[model samples]
Target: MGDIFAEGVGIAGRSRTALAAFALGMSLVSSAMSFAVDDTPGIGAEMAVSSVAGYFLFWQVMATEGLLDGSRSRGAGFMAYAAVSLITSVAGLLGLVLLILPGLILMARWSLAGALVVARGSAVFAALGESWRLTRGFTWPIVGFFAAVCMAFAVLLLPLGIYAAVSDETANIGAAHYIVEFISNVASYGLSALISCGIVAIFALLVDRDERMASVFA
Candidate 1:
């Protein structure tokens, strides 16, 4: 597990450019969603549809530009995106059972698997099988890694929370609420972007490790 984490960290450090691009794209998407929600409180359904569409489009770009060695075939990119989306959707549905524990695990595992499939030009089913096989003996370790990462993220948020609280307490006059809200929103956005980027790095690491192991055994 320590080795896995170390490898992941090293890969992430080396692939900083790709990870930064991905993270920036994610931040833009999230900011757009926030704006949409703020502008139209009752447009949740529209927002959901828009978000899904945007997610797929962005993911297609990521597949072509970042993952597939610069391949930009539209058909292949869309197919890869759809295949991954379908797998994750099915996993989400299945997660409903066992109170969704298994489903969440599958979702996280398949994220890496999807990247591998697209980047390596593997079939969807084959990728799923490989992911399951590779993750077989490391389930608990992966889970623990994710949990620790999430906890670390939460701890990072504490300072932001405190800043918001302090801003709120010190605010005065008519602009107090707006100022506090703006500050809090900005802090939240920044923190969310950082955490999201970390998760993407983690995904990249998992994909790379799985591929290396697969090659070694093959």
Candidate 2:
């Protein structure tokens, strides 16, 4: 787990440029959408946009390891990833609404679906099934990782959260608000990149282990 997380950090570092572009573009869109919706209905829009952004980011991360090296098409991989991720996110969100533990467990189990889609060109259900199989024994560890990641994200986002709250209370919607929000969005996306890369690392580790075990048995 430690090694996988470290590798993910390294991947994020190496792909910082693409990450920056993604962050900037998405943040601008998010801010604009928030302004349009006055921040209420925008919540759902934000979630939808974020889901799509995550799929693109995951694909970019996997591309660093040669996602396009074979005959697999990018369009197909992306569509598969998008479908599976949407399903996972909806299920996880529903679980969270009912009981948070189920949501976390569901997320941990389906975390690798994105990687499987890009790496093996898996279909939506196939990738989800394979991810569940691969993550069976590692669910708790992944949940721990998720906890650590959420803490880090919260810490990084503290400035923006504080500023937003203060702005709301003081009615200070000025130029500085935009500046802070943009910076905060960048930081959030940076963390998202790290999390996506971490998922890729976990996928690679599990696939490698499976291959080694198969060889041993054969």
Candidate 3:
């Protein structure tokens, strides 16, 4: 987990320029969405949107950075990644609603599907299956990683949350609000990118380990 975290941070640092552009674009899009609604859709919805966009942009980054096997099949791989991601997200949400543990397990298990889709040109279900198989022994560790991530996210956003609450109570709608919102959105998107990097790192490590084991057995 520590290695994955370190690798993820390294990836983000090395590709900061591209990642910053992606994060800025996402922040603008999220701001537009909020403006279109005439209200912020609460932090939950914002986080969901950020997560989706982050993975999509991260996949593109991986392709352009030569980290993926199917870089030439970007369009097809993107479509498959989107489809599988939607299903996985919905199913994971359902699992969460049923019981928190199952949802976490499902999410952790299928987390690598997007990486597989873009990196290995896997079909939707195939990617999900491969992710499930790869994550078999790492479920608890992944869950722990996710928990740590969530805590860090909450810490990062806590100031924004407090400010939002205070503003709501005081009806303080002004330039400051917009400024804070923009900053918060950027931070959210940046965190999402980091999470995507970590997942990619995990996917690479798991795939490599699996191959080494297969060779040993063969």
Candidate 4:
């Protein structure tokens, strides 16, 4: 926590500007992809665009994790993570849809998959398997940690939420309102980055703990 707060989480301080730009670009590209496929038929452009967008999101997550772990590799790393995103996402989503508890458990168990894949060049399935193994008996703890993080984030975002709430369904909104909304958006982005950093920190901490436990067993 101290290191992440002081030095710059998974995204190293020096390159955050580049990261923000990259995130912006990926979002725009994803939006364009959706627009391009808006009217496509069954199993068409929408699905393809969704897959691409999912890839970029996964790529960013793993890339940040890798950066925090001091991995110098790029491009190919992102592509690899993107490919693995499909499998992890389906597994997680299925768990969530069929039974919420199962979904939450699966998500918690698989949360470190991105970090594992990024840090080790492991296959997607291998990474997911490792996460499941490492997280054993820790699922509830993981969920509680994220819930606390979200609560803290919500506190920071309260003002924005209030403003948005008050302005809801109003026509002829003004420049001041737009400025408020912009501020809100920037705050949201900062919080999001912090959460990502938190995830990296959690992965590192837990992995270290796992190692120590294994040593005791040995």
Give a tens-digit lDDT track for model 4, residues 24-80. 544454345534645355236535554454344434554645433455354445555
lDDT of 1 by residue, 1-218 (tens): 46556655554555455445444554455445654666465356444553354344434433533545455343454465457667676765677465646755775565455555545656777777766665666676665655565576567556656665676577732455444444444444444334333334444556655657889999
Positional deviation of 146 in candidate 3, in angstroms? 1.1
For all predicted structures, in order, the TM-scores are 0.54, 0.84, 0.82, 0.59
Candidate 3 lDDT, 14-124, residue by residue in tens = 777777977798888777777776554644576666656665677766754456763446455767877887897898889879987888788899999988877778889
Best by lDDT: 2
Candidate 2 residue-wise lDDT, 108-169, digit = tens: 99998878887778888998998999999899888877778878987889868899779968
Error at 42, model 1, angstroms: 11
RMSD of each: 6.2, 2.7, 3.4, 6.2
Runs of candidate 4 with Cα error greater than 4 angstroms are: 1-72, 83-103, 158-162, 165-168, 208-218
Residue 104 displacement in candidate 3 (angstroms): 2.0
Model 4: lDDT of residue 45: 54
What is the Å distance of residue 56 in model 3 from its true position? 4.8
